[model samples]
Target: MTATAVQRFYRYHAYVYDFTRWTILRGRGQAVEQLKLRPDAQVLEVGCGTGLNFSQLLARLDPRRGWLTGLDFSEDMLARARRRVAAHGWSNVSLVCADAARMDLGRRFDGILFAYSLTMIPDWLAALERARTHLEPGGRMVVLDFGRFERWGPLGALARGWLRLNHVETRRPYVETMGSLFDRVEVHGRLGGYWFTAVGSNT
Candidate 1:
């Protein structure tokens, strides 16, 4: 699928995303922990839908010293994030609507996160490369995404197929691509390959 198609997919999903995603999207808080953020760090979250992870991210950040930039391809999704940010009166959080694979914000971040967003990106390798360029040396990047259910037997295929119909491709070599880009990488899979987390540290 193309970037435009992905944006279209989120147009409607954005409305129901916050309410319905809890069923399948798990381990988000733990993934944010992998970032190991400092109170004054500059963080970037790619595809931060509805800003669902903002509370966890912001909890680790000092609004007076730290800042967050949330990027998404769909304005509909961003609109939801904007409301969430405004409702909480979070001044340090900002949202941008742009394609992850092609965005060049001309700056780097201390901690970069791709939570459940990487697998949905069509040019996922490009997105990872772009994210690497936007990461500071010694900074860390965290990827929490759907994993290939390597051991789930028939259920694995069913899960993968269902996710594909929703425009999320799980078979891509996402972890391998990150291994090639970062200085050091560690990966962990959860619940029989239901999801995975990759922490890439740039040395």
Candidate 2:
């Protein structure tokens, strides 16, 4: 999809996004926990829809010693996210409405996350590469999204079909592309084996 189309689609859905979809989604907290950030590390979350996972991340980082930044292409989404940040009274957080594929935060992050956001991006590979570029040395990128179901049976088809209906398309080439940039990649699945979480580190 073109950037305009993507932005429009998300803008229309931003308000109801969390309420409509949070139940089905899984692995976000696990992905955050696996980042293994030090107290002083800086973190960024691309496509931080509604900032649903911000509280989880905050628990892992000390406010006085750590910082967090969230970037998204949709202004509507950023607005809602900012509201959540304000309600939570967090001062160490920042939000930017920008294309993750071309964002220049002017500093590298100790960790980054792409939670349930890659499938919606038209140029996801470019965004992943940008995530790599934004990382400090030894930094890790934690990704959680729908994955191709390798299990056999009629249920797998049903699951894939359900995701397709929502405009979600999981790509397996992500592993190959990530392997080229990251020294180590670990992938795991959850939720009756339909969802996946991947952690890639610069090493």
TM-score top scorer: 1
- Candidate 1 C-alpha lDDT tens digits along 71-183: 99899999999999999999999898899999899999999999999999998988999999999999999999999998999999999999999999999999998899988
How large an RMSD does model 1 have?
0.7
Clashes (N, CA, C under 3 Å) per candidate: 0, 0
Residue 35 error, candidate 1, Å = 0.3
Candidate 1's error at 162, in angstroms? 0.4
lDDT of 2 by residue, 65-125 (tens): 9999989988988899999999989999999888977878788999999988887777888
Error of 1 at 154 (Å): 0.7
Each prediction's RMSD over C-alphas, in Å, is 0.7, 1.6
Error of 2 at 2 (Å): 2.3
